[model samples]
Target: MQRITSFFRFCRGRAKLKRRAAAMGFMNHHHQTAISSGQEGIKTVGVDNHNLCDFSSNSDLCICIVTWNMNGKVSYEDLAELVGSSRKFDLLVVGLQEVPRDNILRLLQAALEETHIVLGKAIMQSLQLYVFGPKNSDLLVKVELQVDKHSVGGFGGLIRRKKGAVAIRINYKGFRMVFITCHLSAHASKVEERNCQCKHISHSLFSKNWNPYAKPAHITVWLGDLNYRIQGIDTHPARNLIQKDLHGTLTSNDQLLQEAERGHIFNGYCEGTLTFKPTYKYNVGSSKYDTSYKVRVPAWTDRILFKIEDAKKINATLRFYESMDDIYSSDHKPVKAHLCLKLNKLLSA
Candidate 1:
């Protein structure tokens, strides 16, 4: 009887493994699925074919992107401020890292339900990205794209969702736009690993196979906890500068900026000025720096950046870039940026 029970257990485990493999294989199918707020509840709606909606020659889209690392903790605080509830943005792109649970999605949907609806979501274990648009807005051509590097230099099996990227592509009135959210390798020492992951994600997500026409996105917005730290600065001095509000001085040593300047990562991407302070290594539920034994040096790990395909056809203006300090639900403060995406049809012609 004992031998029979053991054999049955082994067979059950094999069945579970087969089921997981099937689910992973199904992830390759990209579907345009959206959740909208209705009188009954949240409902998933399948997007129909494209060319259903159109815009004027000179169209403008007000976009707001927010990123945060939750540190695997659940925040009971209201996320209205984090979602920029006061402003009426046409599109809201949210990226979160270290999200052990997805309860925050309900909180976010509740916060924006009155004005916006969830267009799509790409989730890979702990990394999640959600895109929201106005509830009454017109339908546009859109595609959901997600790519995960399950094996990053042999670390993928160990780390899993701690590092990966998800993207959503949208073609609005013939202009293409892509929004990507990623969580790169952590720690200041893993700068090269982060750069390599960034390059891989940027190239892999928008490849020919993902799009039907094999055309690239016109405007790409990348946001997330990139894990790049400030070099040549000790923790003590970095904290001193933070207290003195000398963010400009500290940015000179920013790893991401240095890498971009050297054309290593995000070669064509443009980021708003670093007027806000570092957004990471904060004490949970407080404004103080890390108080643990590691005493991680504060860094601007959460960021929002963008790239434009053609300057003549599209114009991007940064309206506001800031960090939410009052809400300290996690070890990292949420960073938010607002931008105006304007397209001129005359220039393209």
Candidate 2:
């Protein structure tokens, strides 16, 4: 949940934000600057450059992670609903795959400006990771922030940007946290390829060479369109189970789960139960699955998983996980999770 702060005030205009606004040419001139100046540590985005809500004491830290594969399309009108208002969150992390345009960032920033301050974004072509913290909170900006990006697919680096990962790391009040969002190889047959990509991303991203201290993240959340499909079932049976609301039956054969169980990829990570239907390969603008000749099998392609260094030190709880069915702009539905972290007051201080 979000905490209110009394530190907000209306200023005419800040020249720093104005100069930074010119960098995002995708925005119209009439639009006020909605992006960071791309300068030193933790650039704030959107109209509110003021401090975020104070998280100064040991408190339950609420985070919301959303992952969506746009399928090269974006619905500006649905942006508000996409970032749900069911509950207030202290932090918002969004991972997108197959993003067609960069202007969507400006649009999303405008949508969340009232409640959040954009910490920053990591983008590699169509793959993007956006991080936002509570408004008027100095908890995020008081320390150094790091951004890293790496791409894992492509033949001889031909389309490297098409598949890759982006990350944002921050040591907030000595509690190190890393948020990574990635888009891996597609298709049901590319199980090995996706696993390899996950391994490569794990090893390559924020490598020891990049961090002088070589510190491991206290909490790491990896989320995005992983593209792992359900195994041991065809399109017809999978559809039947989905139609019957038996998602648990299909998840039994999920490639990502099987591989993770075998320690092949994302080992030791934990995900919320798959109670919702598969979020991929749907007919655009409809609830129906793929109707093309290929008849792509539906699967839980988009996901969010997290790991904490020591459960004894910090407590983690998954409050809720569900998909947004109303948003029909993309072939794949958007999935979101609400996570609550309880820590000792002194540790979070």
Candidate 3:
């Protein structure tokens, strides 16, 4: 009888413990939820302020916008007008793949009011030797080149060249950020090469390698005319030709997306948004090619990507303007992301 009573007591004790554990779990969950709600509310308030007004008061906040392959063909007057129309962007980091010289860049700087230029290795070398010549090349000498400083890793028999990537660091409102503009090898045979380039960029941004210029505290943005698309299937004539045997491995977007999924990076346009229109068409005299044909253009070659932490602060309904009337600027449409920096929390923290 005593044994049975003891067994009953043990069972009752077990039941009580279970109930207490469950209650504790519920309380903990509730506490976490409340804390998360409070943090979100605070963040929302900060974002609201950033969006509603200029960030002049919060000098610690910096806004960056990038447009790639803005070859010299795009006039400064038109570029200025386009930038002027943007609502709340402060710093513009343009990755001009085929910029001819400093003349056009200087004109753009003058027109944009508060702007600077950072030339890529290819552009710098080409312009130094061709445009400015040896005598007047001291100004372009200060533009740092990352490709020369970093080594790319990949399979055997792959081509590795620094000609593909260019970067510029922006100092704004007491905060600093790096903008890397890259144009990878476009050949279908260069899948391994593109992969190597992606790995190089990933390591450069995340690795603990020491460089006075390349520090981790500053946010990094890898944006430009990537040339490769992340789409599962090819729809454009140019892409169809490239997709025959490579099986989409040649695309930097594919590699970047994979890394992003692993919580390494983030893409701003992953939510069914288009960054570039079919800005390229042969001038066939009388009538331009049907603009509707652009719908069939496969892959988003031009894109913007930021670090994961930066993405967490982004509001869901960020605007990407694609329907502007200025068609003569370049062969690619300029992509913009309206990011609101949470200055109050950052400052408080």
Candidate 4:
């Protein structure tokens, strides 16, 4: 019995050694794969060098943006050029309001090396939107990539029955990050409901129990067409109305104001600009509408907001790239943030 027990133990030790050896061999194989295929084999489980998070030490910054109500005329080719022309952000998040079909989304996915998409709520035939991101070249190389979804409460009213929101998560360069795309209620009366929805989203994120803003790990970026504007205490009437409605809520009017004041949430286009551009407008050129001479008006309804931790990493001169000149893409202009994540330095001790 003693001899038999000794023999079993020896066998078990040998088996463990064999397993370790096999794992090492697999890793070596993947390294060679990465070298030969570039980004194609970077998604393998044991591979560590090719992920976006593992970007070159010199590549410290990432750029992102959000646009809403891009009318149906914007094409994937146009969007790619816009992104390429911009600061080459590591990730791009766009909240597309009124994306009539998946054509543009599909085109973007193809144009970008590695892309992900999350479809937002569709209101009427013309009011569909989506969030897109994590433009890494290696994401498509691996067969193990998985995409998941999280839904948030949207503008609930007669005109828009279900204003939905969705989140997308991806693993890049050894870190995982989350991006949320939201389109809140547009109706002036649903301010309270929209506040509740935002609270729910906050709760859900906390429930995940993951601090995306922390160092050496994942980062969370909450961006989209928040449908809220950040301005002075004596600013636009629309801003005042929103403040009045949420004066005594649990979230607090001060907290909301502080978010904008402290730079926790930034308005990409409002910092230096004096005028408000309305993202939603009547398309005069469309054959469906009359071609009579009428004044074209714009509103600053569509906007991009981000958390303080993420905002701190950006350059001070960030602004919206308004030179695409494609009026047909959507009524809303896309806003971008040029950020360089200094990986060489640590955010914490």
Candidate 5:
């Protein structure tokens, strides 16, 4: 949520948000300068770290992880760009917040149906996760979806998504991967509260339903609008640095990474290098920063981080990591990571 300070005025231009806006539309779309990446060209299959380890020389499976806080907005182009019509990625894991219902999702699936990609979706209050892949890939053995509403808000528990997580664990070709997308408490000052929700997600959400063996997933991806904001700095200076491309300095104070380093949250998870600018608090249809009165300092709220316990056995390599700039349907920019993962059969043995 873009909690603009009392001193600042609200700004949304003259645009009206579509469905799932009234209640969960607390944050509007941004028009700030977005950090874009090069369009995916013909990727060469190399055994280097950029693609995968020596094990995946054949690249048995490739997965693309995307996370977006839709803020009640929908754009078909964004979906197409994410998974691609050609079905380049074997598995597409998507996480979205504030998607009220499945209307737009159904349409998106229908569009992909022509391409023969099977769609699977799960919604928990305001949080949702969608998994799709080539129809005849036949790698899918089991899919387990879990939802937990950890924070209660809105009178009498009317709105169940103030703080919660939705997760799905998949067993493919005798290998397991648990994918989680969560909407934690927002705002800059509530770092500890967000950490608490993360703890709940790590412990309880991965119950027996996710895996019959109770063993951790060979590959685990945790991503979403984690809501970690900048600290120990003035807004004007941070904005100036970001505008000038000195964004890397801000990560040192990032609550999420720091907490992970100290074993407070995301203990075993690892995030790829954040080469792109922060994906939050932007104006709609423009390349400008959060121009609202609250002037929320730019922070990497939307993210896709992962962890692989045995990198040697299941080799998880990041081919490309970037933030989509053109899809300005929400105040937060969508972040995506392309990965090559090997499923270790021994994990289940």
Candidate 6:
């Protein structure tokens, strides 16, 4: 009897593997299949949301998105290493905060030249959202920009500091996506305020334009220095947990997750599992956490989140999610996320 039971278990496991293999094979077929390609050479169009719900649909659209807070310092040194490997992703989205607006934009344009990627949208100040795609790729077009800057810090929300967010929407082979990068309120005790900021930013992005597709974007991406912290623990305990490489355990008290569970912010967005050390409050040029009079507890304040409509119709696969400690110009190390996306049979059909 025991032998028969073991035989059945092995058979079941083999069947599951076969099913997974078949599903993956189907996805690869769509990714490799070319649905459309634009005219060759660099093509820059004005921000136009007038041409959505009318583009042809085909092929897999792979996207890579990176978000960082420069702390008023931008490094062109590890720009290539920032995204690590492209893996032939069709699109690249960069969201930034506290950066040199003009020079950083120029740096991106120059650095991207090596990869032969061209800008899809112009760079905005401080809070920046940039779109890049394969040169001469016509699969993604009809790009549009909507920027909303609401001061949440400094001088009673009057100055342009820790601002709201910047967003850019584009249609890729009939896929609609709105990419937004924002810098919310800081400090540990301001969780409610951060939640409010999130609500405000969400409303601003979805309501900035009159176009229906423009407002209620199909796939919305929110990434930046969100400033969420670990709560219900003293600074020393948090630091000790981080020192012991127990970052995963510390996330139980993450303010952002708590807010989401309470249905107060980012109700439907999903975040990839964070497997890296805390990315904030680091000493410049050192792996050690802040060692000053104000010993700030290390936290994963810098993060990336995503929201989607018709979840059954599309799939998001996270290839990697971690921080870049090598690029050490700011107190908060830059964090990165790589995502491989696919459309379902209904969308493809």
Best by TM-score: 2
Q: Note each model's CA RMSD in angstroms.
A: 14.7, 17.8, 17.4, 20.8, 11.9, 17.9
lDDT of 5 at 252: 81
Query: Candidate 3 lDDT, tens digit per residue, 105-138?
Result: 5565465543344343223421110011112334
Error of 1 at 93 (Å): 0.6
Residue 231 lDDT (model 3):
39
Residues 1-349, model 2: lDDT tens digits: 0110111111113223433554654433322221232212111112111433233233367788999888777767677887866436777889888887648788888888778878878888888888888878767658567888877644223223378799998766466789999888777766656765676677778775575756677789989988899878889998998899887788778988776655556655778888889998888999899999999888999988888877777877676678888889898999988776777555543
For model 1, residues 1-349, the per-residue Cα lDDT tens digits are 4653464355446446544765788421111121121121111122221422122232377777888887776544537778864755677888887775657778888888788878778777777888887787665335344433222321234224466677777655455778888887777866656766776676667464555756667788889988899888899888898899886798888888876655557756778777788988888879999999998788989888888888677877676678888878788898987776677767551
In candidate 5, stretches whose alpha carbon ends up further than 4 angstroms from where it belongs are 1-57, 100-102, 140-162, 208-213, 343-349
Candidate 6 lDDT over residue span 143-176, tens digit each = 4444444444331222234466777767665677
Q: List the residue pairs that clash in candidate 6.
A: 38-138
Candidate 2 collision pairs? 51-136, 51-137, 52-135, 52-136, 52-137, 53-135, 53-136, 53-137
Candidates' TM-scores? Answer: 0.76, 0.79, 0.53, 0.51, 0.76, 0.76
lDDT of 4 by residue, 127-191 (tens): 43333444345544432222233344333333332343555555444434455556665533233
Q: Looking at candidate 2, what is the lDDT of residue 133? A: 82
Record all residue pairs in model 3 with backbone atoms less than 3 Å apart, i.e. clashing.
none
- lDDT, each prediction: 0.70, 0.73, 0.42, 0.42, 0.66, 0.67
Tens-digit lDDT string for candidate 5 (1-349): 2332211111122222411343574532321111122222112222234434332455667777888887766667766765555556677788887664446566567767755454466666677787776676544445443433333222113223445677776766555677888787678866656665676567666454545757666778887888888787877888888888898888786767765555556645667777788888888776678778888888888888777767667866677678888787678888887777655556444
Candidates ranked by lDDT: 2, 1, 6, 5, 3, 4
RMSD of 3: 17.4
Model 5 RMSD vs true structure: 11.9
The deviation in Å at residue 215 for candidate 3 is 6.2
